[model samples]
Target: MAVHPGDSPVHVALRTSDVDEARAFCRKMFYGPLQVNPVGDPAGFAFAGDVVTLGSITVGEISYGADVRVNIADLETAYHVLAPLNGSLWSRHRGTVVIADPTRAAVYRPVGDIDLEWPGDTRLLSVKVERAALERELDAALDQQIVSPLLLGESFDLAEGRGRTWSALVRLLHTELCAEEGLASSPRMAARWRDMVVSGLALTVEHPYGDEPAGLQGPRRPRTVKRTLDAMHAEPWRQFTAADLAAVAGVGVRVLQEAFRQHVGVSPLAYLRRLRLDGVHAELSRSDPWQVNVSEVAYRWGFTHLGRFAGAYRARFGVSPSQTLRERR
Candidate 1:
């Protein structure tokens, strides 16, 4: 998927006193249907908020002036992290219920139905992540095949330590997206930021596979390692996740990671990234500087951040990317 210049950092705001209009707006903003009912007099109800789409993730700030109840059959293709900035939200998912207040946030997975209740004067900050992106990041981080949609624990602590860091990152992303012509407007930077959020969530959220053991305990399979490497080099442009490479090798992610470390001297993802960097170097050597920019060439080969790309390029080749481009020019 090529990113258009104006695709990211898109912001939309809606404010209304009608409950039906509020429900419809929520559905349209998040791409899911919802049943919203007022808990009190409809005349006293009001909704106000803005949602910003940054890359594949959507960040929204919403508020309701009166108590309300909402039911959704399924989120289908997205995962949401809902944190209350003020007031409170009671959320139920897969039989577990949690009150998401200032210190506790709710992680809503894509597979199950969701029910939420908002007290009068409640306000929330939400991060909506694409399901595929989240899954791919998790698989890559764990180096294993995830059999189904992730079932995260109900409440996430936001007041201390890891939770605090994660919450801060979200706030930073939200602030940047709301800025005028933010860094998200740059394709490379946007991708890097999006990856940060996805990877951060994978590490922060509590999951069943969080404690999976690493490395092969028995004999290492050389054939499996070779097969995985061959597949990686065959199509370096593809966004190959750990699960994808593991499937190619016919082994689990931990086994694949161990195999590569024993035989290839690097992890599977690292090897793949090295191949991509090499491809970027070769392309830069062949293209004209007059027509090609470093960011364009780097992005073409899946290098998302320009700063990181430059550092890696220099570390690998002992020359900056611009120096290479100058040689070709």
Candidate 2:
């Protein structure tokens, strides 16, 4: 149940036989102040794990040699996913019990207490995403405010559909970061990978907005919609807010929003984001990666947040911004 063959390319962050030391390491690295108790002989207990920080996300491969029970009171500012590589994991979150294995994973939100039972010799790929980062990605995707404490399913299936694809993306991230010479060294590439992981989870897991369609096709464009579109296309790099776009269309913000939804199938800000993404793509396609990195191009197109930009770019273009830059033809 190893995450890698032989030895992992990612350096081990912690390896200890003392339960106190292991608990301290987990507190500092993954979660804050949790209780870990051995389920079997204390003498057989051991801990080994590797951890890496990618922007607002933390990825780790962890294993406790003996069976143990973990009690976490609150995750506070982050969301967690524990996907076992070999043995199954028993997790209780929000009053539901889930037996997570290779085919299924456990997801914990920021608000609730989590109890987990790890069987002997179980290895797990652990992902921690900051709450703000994940929620921002969701907000951007839905173009609206998200309800607090997102109702994510306690158990996620990793054997089919988007869950399977998300699992593969997580493994790929692990592999790249573990490699000696991988693209993850670049900040831009790391940001892109982090966004992919967060966005993938948002799309894969059961949530309020999960059932919404990708886009809505509406009727023909009106004059106000046409004016707003012209303004956005003409100055994609300008920092145009909803009020600014509405002003350009000679209407109130709500009227402009309704008009855009009726004609463009998205809000003015969302359509403007699409325009900015297109600008970045066009610039990256012609620029050399060695001379100009993805961030510079992204920033030039009014993308202040690299993680959100990467998620939006990939959602629109089916590839990362760095990939578009590297594979320019």
lDDT of 2: 0.77
CA-lDDT, candidates in order: 0.76, 0.77
Model 1 Cα lDDT, one tens digit per residue, 214-286: 2212333378976886677667778889999999999999999987886656789987887777678767665
Best by lDDT: 2
- Residue pairs in steric clash, candidate 2? none
Worst 10 residues of 1 by lDDT: 210-219
Question: lDDT value for candidate 1?
Answer: 0.76
Instruction: Give the clashing pairs for model 1.
Output: none
* Off by more than 4 A, model 2: 1-12, 212-329
Clashes (N, CA, C under 3 Å) per candidate: 0, 0
Where model 1 places Cα greater than 4 Å from the true spot, the runs are 1-7, 211-329
RMSD to truth, every model = 17.6, 15.5
